[model samples]
Target: MALLLLAQIASGDSGRVELIAHPEVGAQLLTRDTTRAIFAMRQRTWPDGQAVRVFVLANEHEDHVRFVKERLAVYPHQLQLAWDRVVFSGTGQAPTRVTSPTEMRERVATTPGSLGYLATEHLDERVQVITME
Candidate 1:
């Protein structure tokens, strides 16, 4: 199932949502599982062991939906539930929510070890785009 999903992303236009990270993250690549874990609040650090911080757009936002579905291959409701469970269980915290892509970019760029997704046009050199490995 994971292989199928990765194939789908590889064969299709997963470019609509681009995974981005703070420049301080250092690593320029991540596997789908790692990316999913980070966004799902299950991973607390990058591959290099730097603390991971996640930023996101609102749950109902279109970009958020696309990023969750295309990039993470998970439905937004499912992701939200996962976050809620972790937060309520005292095992994790929810991602920082931003109102727009500009804010998303800004927050991710400024916050060390931050990771997020953005539409191509909204992206800038403030953050680094990590390739799916």
Candidate 2:
């Protein structure tokens, strides 16, 4: 049932949406290396040395937050702690939180070297989705 739903979502409108990536962006986001890259702020730069911005769905949506947490095997609380540590240390900033998927997609598309995830249902021509293995 879940597989069917994902397929429906993934194939809904290929023309309206596309998965995007930096030239070096890999296929899967859940792997240890990919996850590390996505979170470490190292992968934020593009092939041109542009800074990458990350936009994330706000925590009000339980399912979305759970998806990221579970896929990365890190609880929300743990993520918060890590964010705080990074912020305090002046190393990196936590993802910019937005109220809706629409907002997330907009911000990601406009911001150079930006990357983020949105519901397949919410995807449209304006933005791109990067595949995750």
Candidate 3:
């Protein structure tokens, strides 16, 4: 099931981005809406109720741009605006901003309840790939 979903997401583009979550996040599949909400910092927990820790690359990073545009189906600035509102309003916190893909993978792998994205080539067993519905 996981492999099928992964192939479907990774099928079209050579430069695709995929979700990499902490091994303990406890969800094999998440609705696209839920994933978006999480990245937007609107949703604070996983389906099983673990506090979510979202990680993202700088706005200008290519993989970050692709993940927002392709997987989340939102523009980079749109996501940034949502985050700005949350932080500016003091309602919630922004997702952790990592400097590079290696940092993204490292943080997500070591942080429990964390979620992040990486190019297919950077993925390894340290983290689990989650499929978006």
Candidate 4:
């Protein structure tokens, strides 16, 4: 794990970005595709049928851009378009946006079934890390 993190850093991937979830969230592991779908707001519930609450930072934020690109394998613009389409078409709602990483951490920690990304340095026992495959 240390080697992989080092490699990501060496490759200019600010690997500090991590997928975090509310402590009460049931999921501990998820496939990359499922994670993308959740972030894209296509999957409204977890595999176990629990409702999902997705949170995000502003699209143009560096961590947001990096998390979209490096983790979800999508561009920030594309993710925005997806959210816009759903919201405009009245199908789904966009993820709640937090103003800063501090708010992201706070919201994710307090909201059940919530998921968001944050830098590792901001992590605390209040939230759980959701590992992606």
Best by lDDT: 3
Q: Could you tell me how far off, in angstroms, the CA of residue 43 lies in candidate 3 after the best superposition?
A: 0.4
Which segments of candidate 1 are over 4 A away from where they belong?
Answer: 1-15
Give the alpha carbon lDDT tens digit for every residue of 1-133 in model 1: 2353355467774447789899878888889888999889999997788999999999999899988998788999999998999999999899989999999999998999899998766667788888886
TM-score of each: 0.87, 0.67, 0.90, 0.88
Model 4: residue 124 alpha-carbon error in angstroms: 0.8
lDDT of 4 at 89: 96
Report the C-alpha displacement of residue 43, candidate 2, in angstroms: 4.7
Which wins on TM-score, candidate 1 or candidate 4? 4
Best by TM-score: 3
Clashing pairs in 3: none
Better of 2 and 3 by lDDT: 3
117 Cα displacement, candidate 3 (Å): 0.2
lDDT of 4 by residue, 5-110 (tens): 5665687755469999989888999999999999999999987888999999998898899889988999999999999999999999999999999999999999
- Which tens-of-lDDT digit does each residue in 94-131 have in candidate 3? 99999989999899999999999998777778889898
Q: Sort by TM-score, best first: what order?
A: 3, 4, 1, 2
- Per-residue lDDT of candidate 2, residues 1-133 (tens digit): 2453367668773223233333333332344446545554445554455676766665556645654565555665665676677788998888778787677767766766676665556665555445545
State each model's CA lDDT, in order: 0.85, 0.57, 0.89, 0.88
By summed lDDT, which 10 consecutive residues of candidate 1 come out lowest?
A: 1-10
> Which RMSD does model 2 reach against the true structure?
5.9
